[model samples]
Target: MANKLIKQMGLPKSIANIFTARNIITAKDALSHTEFELMELLDVDKEEVTSAMAHVSEVVCPPCQTALLLLEQRVRNETLAGHLPTHLKGLDEALCGGIPFGVLTELVGPAGIGKTQFCLKLSLLASLPASCGGLDGRVIYIDIESKFRSKRLIEIGINSFPEIFLKKGMAQEMAGRILVLRPTSLSEFAESLYQIKVSLLQQQVKLLIIDSMAALVLGEHECGTSRQQALGVHVSFIKSLAEFSRIPVILTNQVRSQFGDESRMYSFQEPLYNKR
Candidate 1:
């Protein structure tokens, strides 16, 4: 757009074309271009480059600013400011409040670490009212290892909502809240990815739990590198769901230890993002 503005003001076509081709479509780029650099590209002297810049400056417009006012009451809502607590005070405080919304949380550890149990508890808690440390929304648990305990959820519902259980149709209603899905294989898991997104809005889900992400990745019959690529794909899909729906997505996984480590070889809690 900056280049087009300069072109409309009578800059030569060849010169304007070079702006985009050289990745200098912005006025800032034009301003930063060295006299020697412009000489090479424009076949002009330093004086001509300076003259061209003055013309470019006139076309370079600053972005306009806008402001908004939000209601005081809406600022403190559960979906935005507040987090979905696990209902365990110690655990919740340790996590600096609770499991937050609108992002993916990956939990990695070996077996018998209660990853599945913790997820089950969170799913049950997520169905509770906001005053009870929940988002008051539905849960979708994608089970890859067939460890989804429906009985556990029912027991929790009974204890958590005993009064609700006393009423007719409430037990069945509570049972329907936490939807369990067991994808038999990684390929099958991939097929259900799209439908899960649709279910989030339709069912009004705000918390998603995937029990053991490793099962789907490691179960694939392919090279180790291929498994890594598959993991990337799975991460991308879940990330899209979290960001688009503005909900918390928790995924558990297992890690392997390398044998040939002489001294702290397999250690890493690296930053999630880095330059390639």
Candidate 2:
């Protein structure tokens, strides 16, 4: 099957022979090895390995659909599909329903502005039964700043949804659905995200909350450019994860007063991505 697909790709005969020699006779076999491994196995250069891998990925993966079809699907399933409401009436209205799925929704503010609190609320809400306007699925809360308090989450849950959370073991069950991960460094954070991507479906994740991306990026000891580049890569991976999982991702960020203007505050980490 892999040989047929590779031949259909019009790749050179040498590359085809390498696959045959290596016993890479299936798309899964071809994709199971990384590019570096494939290069070593096939004794081919990076370009040939890359081209072959790309062809295998395209052939094995799901077919790509048009944007119009995607839009139509979303429209047809809007009520059941995309958004996850915070269940905060005013905020929900202000947000045009709720935080949308398949994108990064940032909550930026000063230190005491309830960013983590809001995240906690969303976490509990996401774990509730779907009949109660929740996603009825698990949550992945990456607590970068160590701000996640299970006690506070319980307090909010009980206070907001007393009927649902007051039952014995109900709160425990809700808390069990939320997996909190704390990664002390940027590399560890990236690794955690990668692990989450691999376990997303199995874990039944409906929401992903990174409490303050700024903390991880700012804590990095690298110079500004390097930090920015690393941050960009991590951000792209996170966006990809959200889109691929079709889940709502909430990221918190801290704000600082503009250098020359105390009256105006902006995301402290914004400069890393947007330099004037």
* Residue-by-residue lDDT tens digits, candidate 2, 116-166: 999999999899989988989999999988989999999999899999999
Model 1 local distance difference test score: 0.69
Error of 2 at 257 (Å): 5.2
Q: Against the true structure, what is every candidate's RMSD? A: 7.4, 9.7
Error of 1 at 240 (Å): 1.1
lDDT of 2: 0.79
**TM, every model:** 0.69, 0.66
Query: Candidate 2: how many backbone clashes?
Result: 0
Q: Candidate 2: where is the Cα deviation over 4 Å?
A: 1-80, 257-276
Once all C-alphas are superposed, what RMSD does model 2 give against the true structure?
9.7
Model 1, span 1-276: residue lDDT tens: 554544454666767776667666666667676778877876767786777777777567554543322322222332364566776789667554677666677776667788888887788777766665556789888988888877877776677667655578766665678888888888778777788999989988978988866677766645656776777777788888887888878888765543465321111113231100
Clash counts per candidate, in order, are 1, 0
TM-score, structure 2 vs. true: 0.66
